[model samples]
Target chain A: MASIVWLAPAVTPATEAGDDPLLPPFGAELIVDFDLALSPYSEGSDDQQEVFRAFALGLHAGRRWHRWGVGLAVEGTLWRTLDGRGEDDWFGALHTGLEGSVLSAGGRIRTRVGGGLALLLEGTALDSAGGAGFYVDLRPAGLRWALDDAVVGFDPLTLFMTLPDAGGIPLVDVQYRLCIYAEFGR
Target chain B: MSARTYPLLLAALGLMTLPAAAHGYSLQTAVSDSCHERITVSSLDVLLDLVDDVSGFEVPDDPLLRQLLGRLQFPGTEDASLQVRFVMFSIIIGVRSPDTDGHSTFNLAALRRLHADPAPRGQYAHALRGPGDDGIAGDLAAVDGTIAAILDEVQTGASLSAGGVIADKPAYLDHYGVVDVPVALFAWHVGRALHALQDAHAHMIWDAEVEHIVGVLNYIDAVEGRLEDADGLAHSDALDDCHRDDVAPLVEAATRRTRALTLAIVEAARTRDGAALRAGLAPCVDDATDRDACGWIVYNPPCRAAIRAGDTDAVEAVCCDDANDFCGSPYAAIARQEAVGPYLGCATAPAGQSGGWAWGLGLLGLAWLGRRRRFAAPTALALLALARPAVAAEADEAADAADAPPRLSVVVEGHGSALDDRVDAAILSPAFGYGVRAGWQTGRWRFGLHVDRDYWVSVEYGARVDGGVLDVAAFAEGLFFDDYVRVAFALGTSTLMFDTELHSTGNTGVFSEIRPLGLRFPLGERLWLVLDPFTTTVVMPAIELDDRLPSLRKVQHRTIVGIEGGFL
Candidate 1:
């Protein structure tokens, strides 16, 4: 039985309530975001405040059980500094962790958190600060559109590293990756 | 036996009598009123002397047995004393006969139920019912003879079979009937009977206020034998409000008939006449109305309500309190109301207000359809038309049935920090800057990006020279004990971008930070205030001497407080 609500954008299936345990697995998502960064440690008295424009596309494959799922994601990220400086870079990270669907009906929100490693590749030349870097990722908001099989979401990805010491000025390197993952599994 | 041994025999049988005061209250007083003290004491003396003569056994005599005899003297409860004790004594002796098993006759559970917690409609009540009740005529009819047989067997040293069905192996029989039934066992059983009987005597005084009134009536019964005959105590104005007429007849009938009935059975037992024993015990057979004799016809109102409400724990507690001095369980349902209310959603918004959401959603759905952008108008119009009534009920149902997973939140923080001395001297000025952070929280962990920029300005050769440093780092955080406090470590890259009138350079290097403290405060259902403070270290990459850029490595400290909010 399906009932129409006046303000509802689409008629949701009345059967969705008891069928959550039987929903199909294997899903995908895409996301676009802007990241704001603050570096408190510098060589001198000047504090650093910078915003970066970034986008990421990730492919996820995982198995879903009753209410939750564990999966792996390989993502590509592109970021550019908005400090009026000519600098940009591209990198990739691998993430695997637990993700689960929450809320019922058309308001399904998915969340994921896990740790992995990242590598920086090309773009605006700043310095040779590239390597295999470890990082953690968290996706707080992932929502599926009504009557759609796909999901859209965004996450804040953090990289952890120790660099070779050069000279006097202190540097605080902060990087955030914003990506949308499209699920493709059964 | 010699005359001197007669007194000793009476003492060992626990039937020694003392002088009775007028209007005296106790089992002693009650027994003294109904039976001639010399006759009753001498009767027990003769019975025990015969047991010793026939069985060649010494009657057990100890201070503990004397103390038990004293405790059986229930003060101010005359109605239960003579008749109730006689019936119990007869039953205790009758069980020893080979015709019937003593264990079958002794229903200890039934006895305990009657004595301590009499239920209104049960075998216990029926057994205590005086006469004309089905229970007396049916299940309880054999109890007296059974107990008397048991007592007989105990005195005769008739060994009972061990390890059989419940009726063949009663605990009380084995315990008290051990080794030619000790005199102490008889005393203990008498005490138990007095305990149950005394409660029956005061059954009419259900409320605490009239308890003393019942005691006075019992005292009157002890001295006067019946309340029908007025005494100074009974005629007192203090009892004017008490409808004594209603209760007096019942007590009088039960007491008088039970005493007569008991004496007849004992006399028949003495003569060993099966026919007379059956005829003498006829009055003990209860008719229907006699079931109320146990005085548990009415239940406490709260206890009744709790039972009707299906609160078994409350009912158990309340009923136990009403039946006994110590309530069995102290589970108060009211105490747990608050904690259970939220989980069961006892407080839901009213129907009218909740139904409004449907109309709102319908209008929005219509507007979206009217735009002809995302969805076709025909499908949207159909949805809008059907949604008005359906949405109201369906939305409520969905909300009620939905189960949600843990939510995710984003936190944005900004704070100031100072760079260490290594880079201050190279920059020719002290460097200080502000760092900002943006992160998302998932369950117990937080992941975020942070960046800081430091600026230095100095006068070189009378001209203004300005320099800046920037650092970027990413942190992964974990909370302890699922508490609001979090600690995290960061790793990323930093670039020291410097430019003076003489030279400018961007030296990119490694940077890291340690987040030692993060305190969070929940603002509402989905918002939280977070305070995080940390230290960061920025390492610069190697530079050529020909490059006109300053090299720097430094550590900085910073703190940030912010808010996090999200949706489920």
Candidate 2:
């Protein structure tokens, strides 16, 4: 009887069964993200065919209800190069976004989409020097591997498009990121 | 928001874009580059002429002289004959090194670094004028002393050498401490002394009536919030621009003095006469009679009376007239009355517009909170009360209650970066930091102010980089597993200041720290030992990267261990 009891499946909470395994109901995460540009474009440069790369390190504080989550993230991105030419540029962005798993494969693999307005720091990306600007940062599609305490995700279709001022061309770039997230909370 | 306010808003925005007057000569405006290089090149020409006239002096044969001449002539060129560039570029390194990659490359990174650290006032020959002409005299003496040190080193090197051939011998330590046998050291010191001599001309007003340079604007006094004491003008405040048309006469005088000093140094080296060197420095130093006379013109009773009565024309006629003879008893009396004080150190103020945006955002956050709830009123009051030492002491004592959590807490910790992706281990050692945080705690939330200083040392070049971060943050924490494990999220606005070998640079940015795991152990009634196993800090617009290293990842992870104590 003891052996049978030990072998039998344990009862799982209804919320735990439906929720993403790695993320807590309420948690904070430190995210280290590496981004590779797909369609690199900059309004400041004449060439649009070059590659752009950036590393974004951020902190996300959020709460999750089942498969859907909302969070505020402050990300500092160090761009290796904006126009494939090796010049360093830095930007600090504050983002508010919603993330929800659209498809769940065995509750281990989840397809997610997240997006938000990334408000850029003033005088950072603005052509007029001190002017304020923002970018529409979107994770159109992503795949996440749920672990016991961490979530490793790959965002294949991340897009960043600047909301330009008058007479300014919209700068757009498509990037892919490998995100490592360490989460804590209930 | 109003139509009438649009122009004012636009004007304010334009004013924000206007560049502030820089310290010393404006290096960014290329004024220093142009003026210092021009004066130096012309001085070299004079030295060459003097050398040609001297019988025993061999310009081409003497490796030291030839090297000095060649390096000054073709600086930053491929032909490295002891490559010393312009006085601003080479010798100015002794006063304030330009933010370079240790190489002569001046890029955007170097320019940004310059924005961080301005030249220290009164150093580098930016002397005070008027009643305290002794400052300029002292600065010239220091330059003379440096010249003497160089000559002494040269003589010592000659004595130590086999046949008095000190040239092409390893005599002194270079910036990197590499033992390179070059004639750069002698030229470097000469150029360094000449820098001060030339600045004496640019910094002082060339009094046409007295036919002598007088009235140097005091940068130290100006920066110390003593503008009246500084003669109502700050050093380098739109006044010391070498390219200005009004500054043409001063620049010419600088050029002449520079030539005179250079010629004297060459002559001294040729004849090996210390007296000749002293004679050469005389042209650069302040004249005691002229200085005394000028002091009386500004400080005499009649001039002071006119100044007090707002009779500027009368004061100018009586005190500043060319033929005025107030250089007698009044000069002596005023000199005794207006005795100058000991020189104060450089200003600790940050050079440019930094920390303002962070403070603005913090205030805005408070306002937003106030609008959201009435509870913010007491919080704001508490923050204000914390500024007073006595109130803070009381708050600390009150927070030591055993029944409830502390209302006020303080934490002091020494933290070192456990992981750094940006630093090259071969070049630079890991950075270590110490910080203090103090604030009020209510329930599960803590709001506080923290100040941290991080230091980095270059193992290869022996250069030191110091950084300061001042932050106002709010932390939310939760305890689980019998109150043993704690997790906290900290969000703040951080103003980061960096003092590098080149200059000081700083930026205001938002920073977030997520302590995923922390262990707390009680030590006493009010004290606890807290160990944060994992703390990841991400500062926006990232802290200025070390120029000596290649740019890489910005995130730095630190393990912080500290003692937290609750106070009344």
Q: What are the chain B TM-scores of all models?
A: 0.24, 0.38
Q: How high is the DockQ of candidate 2?
A: 0.01
lDDT per residue for candidate 2 within B203-255, as digits (tens), equals: 44445432343334444344333334324224443344566665565566666
CA lDDT, candidate 2, residue A174: 24
What are the runs in model 1 whose C-alpha is more than 4 Å off? Answer: A1-52, A82-107, A123-130, A146-181, B1-568
TM-score of each: 0.21, 0.38
- Model 2 chain B weakest 10-residue run by lDDT: B419-428
Please report how far candidate 1 places residue B129 from its true position, in Å.
99
Tens digit of per-residue lDDT, candidate 2, span A82-145: 3112254443334333333322312222233444333334323222222122334444223344
Q: What's the CA RMSD for each of the models?
A: 35.0, 22.8
Indicate the DockQ of the complex predicted as candidate 1.
Answer: 0.03
**What is the clash count of model 1?**
81
